[model samples]
Target: MKRREFIASAAPLGLLFSLGLGDVPFANAQTAGGTPVPGGVLNVAVSPEPTLLTSAFITTMNIGQVSSKILEGLVSYDLNLQPVPALATSWSTAPDGLTVTFRLRQNVKWHDGKQFGAADVQYTLLEVWKKLHPFGRAAFANVTAVDTPDPHTVVIRLSSPAPYLINYINTYGAQILPRHLYEGKDVLTNPVNNAPVGTGPFVFKEWVKGSHVRLARNPDYWQKGQPYLDGVVFRFIPDAAARTVALEAGEIDVALGSSIPLSNLNKFQDKSRYSINLDDGRYLATIFLTQFNVRKPYFADKRVRQAFAHAIDRNALLKVVFLGYGKPATGPVPSSVVNYYAAQTRQYPYDLKKAAALLDEAGLKPGKDGKRLRIALDYDAGGGVTATRPAEFIKQSLARVGIEVELRGGDTASYLRRVFTDQDYDLMISSLHRLPDPTLGVQRLFWTRNIIKGAPWTNGSGYSNPRLDTIMEAAGREADVARRRALITEWQQIVQEDVPVLDLVEQTWVTVSTARFQKTALQGDGLFASYADAWLTPKKA
Candidate 1:
């Protein structure tokens, strides 16, 4: 059974709209007849508030969910996952695959009333993404230059063939930013990050702290007569049960990111009241793993890392923690991404005896108090039960082997800073997306160059292997498909042997919404889409 789905409205508007809450704006939205209605608010439930609006630098799921609507990518993917036009009308690649060119759409303007052009794309790629973006550091490593012949034409020059470069030009990945605003400023600390300006279907309205983020429709949207809904309000409901109850009560129209607990999904199984999506808007193929601070002397030993892997039972973690929503992962890449996934590598089946022996070999024997070593474990507080439960489970499992774990947690914003920026964690638990391609997702987690401070979803472990880096860099530039796959396989094996981080499970999340919502499934990403064409139908007569 497909475990994850989102919730949309099938009934009429709730009392919240009738009472008139302008601070968190909502409307009596949707169609009267068969045609889609132009006016109404699509109230969405986003569990944790995003740290910022734009996903150009930080690819946090919540950030992508909201920012995708405001920021327009050069292209958007089709139902077949093929690149289609968004900001860039047309594009071409050189025979050698080293040079690619894009023709920007004319008459398109940024949210701040500036003309969108090649200069915006050029600066976003070279200055922002390459320098600051966690994944872009690895994905766009070979990018030598982004030349703009005219205001509408952008020519990208690469040092080697990057066949997978086209896959990440979408809004959720390499979002285009305005050159005028970001020209001579510190991007990370820029005030505009809190209130983004973009070229998309939605305009930046207001974000009430610890409340909701409200967005209004962009009247000057490049797509003609589209983005049918008037606006969107993503409410922050911290509790999973409360989010589900709100959806059931019609307070919120939709809920994505599996905010509702898996055990509660049966209540919404009645198709008449609720609609479900399996593989839609879920471009993020998530891998739930624990990253260790390898800089610490206790965790630096290879045997210690291997012992930690053997200590945890992956099968039990899948069944108990995730409620069997996913399968145990083999390596960095999950089985869902069949193109590059490595089927065979070193396996760490549950073996208490082996775990104890390995720990002893690493000179981490039980002391007078029966404690081998003490460590702190941090987790994403926003992930609700899914994240919190796993931390507890790992702690329990590791306890049997004489390792004492102190669970640490905080808000999503502070958690990212603690682990990635401060590097304050001994062991950090995070569920990160492996994206559509390994170059865009998997490589960033292990690549030496991607251990950037203040960047989330990066190599915070401080682990580096020159051979693995060589393999990853070659795979990124490799033109031949078979050769690239082989290189990727080798990369997985090296990580498995080194055990920098324990790749636990590959999760398949769901999106639940009502049938009244339209055009959400048009894009391959499902609920993670820009929602430009998304609108609601009228209540059942």
Candidate 2:
């Protein structure tokens, strides 16, 4: 089927997103009441088959949703989003903030049975993460060396203090990989990315492409006899309503990342039969946006970009499309991401008159055909309501200001290739995650050095501002909270003035599971959590 026709045929779930996906039901999802019994396979539903199974070099949410189960990181986060121990038993930073050291947990074995130690930490930090991780290239740029004093001790020496460093040690941001396998292999194409070996609770079993990725529990998991389900099977179901049907018919036990249509959630209201989880996604707070390819001639001027921002009716988009599920994003930092969020950053409301004047002033006046310029809107295929409604809304909104719109869509792999790898779109709409910290997740979107070709989720806009780059560098290296906060404030203001990408709305996320699912989402990352402690209640409940 053609990409344009994909949206037309997609069944819209509309305005019925999830609650506690930043709504009033913001409490941690309650589990079924009973003595937790283990041994059943935890069937997890994931939409759009993921392209890869590891996050060592890539950080797509779909990939992380599954890969984190196999590849563990140095630390995990708490309900409060504070760093907690995982593979690293304890960690400390020098008073100067340049030297950080961690004591590795002993007796840990990679899924392949190799003893996990400091060498793996040293190699992962220096090799794949520092160079290939989409966000790590900017986040870990100051790391000068990783010193392994022994099998259990690893020291990270940085050229400058990176106050944002610790926050990124979570599995999704800096997932540690085994060096014995990747040391001499091509990290990007290493067969291990497709079939991973790690120290997490689950072992990579097999990935039957176009179908599912199965993971068996690690009997030798460092956590000890945990991840109580006998195994986990992530099923790939592309249709939205079909996922809802699977959940209803017991074909799948749980749906994380809102793969199931939320409007149907009301059917599972029997507390004994099911539960909804929303509290644990704080670590992956996200913003939906339409980013311009500033390298293009029509978007070369900042006024043209700002005009595009003004043409967006964000409030209407939230009301009509999002159905009060989220707020209009005022800046790059979503309000859900606390600290360093500049609430007072400049805002562009829906003003067609202002939009038209900005375009005219930039010398892009309407032609005899009543259009200033024609541009293609590119986005991933089959995002259900989120992608389809927003693309059409933006296209119609731009038409009002004398801009002609052409819609473009592709499957997951092709869309990422076109936008981030090929840099092929005039404007593209996708959700960008602002991880627990801005320096860890947000800087890569605007920093000049992050414009590496073929890197998914990096700076694809070709926006370069030396002043903003310097401020971001200082913000990353600044150990003082007040100083870093001030720098982030300036960074937010400058990006607005430049208008490289239009921040659309804070995204809504959700998870659904039968009441039998136990101890799955107690951490800040929630469903994205490695599920090390996740278990299941006996079927007879």
TM-score of each: 0.81, 0.86
Global lDDT scores for all candidate models: 0.77, 0.79
User: What value does the lDDT take at residue 522 in candidate 1?
Assistant: 56
Candidate whose TM-score is highest: 2
Give per-residue lDDT, candidate 1, residue 165: 87
Give per-residue CA lDDT, model 2, range 303-387, as digits (tens): 9999998998987887777565566778888766667778887788889999999999999999999999999998876565557
lDDT of 1 by residue, 184-258 (tens): 999888888878899889898999989999999999988888789999999988777788899888788788766
Please give the RMSD to the true structure for each candidate, in Å. 8.0, 4.2
- Reference-based lDDT, residue 29, model 2: 59
